[model samples]
Target: MTSAEVTRRRAMGAGLGALAGALAGCSGASGPVLRLRLATGPEGGPYNAFGQALAQAVAASGHRIEIVPVSTAASVNNLRKLDDGSVELALAMADAAEDAVLGREPFPRPTPVTALARVYVNYTHLVVAADGPVRSVKDLAGRPVAAGAAGSGVQVVTERVLRAAGLSGAPEPAPVPAADERPLGLAASVSALREGSVDALFWSGGVPTPALAALAREMPLRFLPLDDYVGPLRERYAPVYTAVTLPAGVYGLTEPVGTIGVGNYLMARADVPQDAVRDLLRVVFDRWRDLLREVTAGARLEPRFAISTGEVPLHPGAVAHYRSVYG
Candidate 1:
């Protein structure tokens, strides 16, 4: 709770209110201006990039709608913002959002939010320098590790995966700088990995992440398999995790890496106008091809599985969209 964070929160609040106000007023001729505040993850991560792309798509739809993308720590942070009224729309991991509602780890109490769609799967990448000593999660013992930024979904999953692997205290979690100071979450971790500040990095993101890909090109790297922890993780946390493979050579690796996949959800405050949510869903599902071309991770948002939000309830607007499509 730094002054900088307070100031940023205030600015976001203003933007959300302004958008809500505009959406409240409409004329049959031009329609009302709809402004939405979308809270995304770290600056260089997939959440921020995909959110910006979504905003652009909504803008290009020729509707009187404008989405403002705000960069914040992903997952846990986004749900907090939604609860406090600073963010109208956001992206969160299915597990973290469920935790928020259940007042589980990473959340102090139940947070009310609604899901627009289950957008994509974020694969856990336990990356180490190819020449480094660590070959597996157990090897990370007594080493420094970047376990993801504090208050991020990455951190949430990182901790669970480690605990399930029996390495909960094996490595020291990297110190996270203040929110405003951390522009790119994984970029900082990658820098630490490259500089030997940390021996291994735990990142949860869509495949072919720009920062990781760039790091792979500069130096050899390898992804440690988390196959052993999948069942235990499911037993401890929500069942939102699934097994997935990282194709060989995706990040220039020699063999496919096994990892757990967690779904990413597009979320909103429950009070947001149902019609507005419906329209947003339309932009996402109806024009999904456009999103897929823009964001590689967008390909995971299969319409048939879009409504499979675990603990967090789907927004009424999302329900309407599905009914319109199916019924």
Candidate 2:
């Protein structure tokens, strides 16, 4: 080819490349959008389901909310995600958030977090099959138990309960694998117990969790009372633990069972934008009824009940939202 032809071809290629780069920059095809990231628990769990429902609700409110829901280990890991700025928002057990701020174990140092809202009450259920060998937390010793996924809030509560029950040194509970080796969340734990793979399972979630409710239909399940442990847990940790009871009709139990309750918080990093946080609070409270049809736990997120976030401070945007509505 002639030298002039070669030069012209090179210039054309350069021009096309520059145009492509400019278009890529403007469209951000290879870069992430500014949509907010919400970290939830393992897939198929209440956290995941609730987060998805919440994301949908927020998105439907307006184009201002574009949420990307991510499934991670519940609570503990979600806090870690907030710490590292990997996620803008997360659902966490109130106890785990307290532990993180206090620099407790599982957290090497204090991790700052702010409560967007007090979402729901997580009931700690020490569940077993009606005909299983395990009768109580004491009986969990030396038996295969689903202790929740490692690095999850459920596991933290489970370990604490075992310690409080004087069963800490008992053989490590069997890990309920979510998909592989990951610690099982509430849904998987119930499945493990129903399958008879584990003698007992420790699950912390909203009362009448769909999974447990469905399991109750297929077989009779029993919840071991843990009211005795609530006082100790509350005394040792923050006042995040409460002594509560699962009503007789819940989960098909013929009698009420005493258990501990921990509130769940919708948490955000301290630096999350006020406007975005404000929008979140808008959907959470203004359109709450819509969320109720989405997640059964949504019933617990009533406006009157959502302002009790314990030691975790509310985001200023949340504060404003509450004032605007309540005032």
Candidate whose TM-score is highest: 1
Model 2 global lDDT (CA atoms, 0 to 1): 0.75
Clashes of each: 0, 1
Relative to the true structure, how large is the alpha-carbon lDDT of every model?
A: 0.78, 0.75
lDDT of 2 by residue, 40-126 (tens): 988878788778888888868863556778999889999998877777789999889877766688898666677888877788888
Q: TM-score per candidate, in order?
A: 0.87, 0.82
Tens digits of lDDT, candidate 1, 1-327: 332343344334433342355464576899787778999987867888888888889988876778889999888889899888887888998889888766676677666677889887888998989999989876765577888887798888877776655566433255222111122268889998899878888888878777888899999998999877788888877689899888886899888889999988999877677788888888887676666553354365577788888777777778888999877
Cα-based lDDT at residue 267, candidate 1? 92
Please report the TM-score between candidate 1 and the true structure. Answer: 0.87
Would you list the clashing residue pairs of candidate 1? none
- What count of clashes does model 1 give? 0
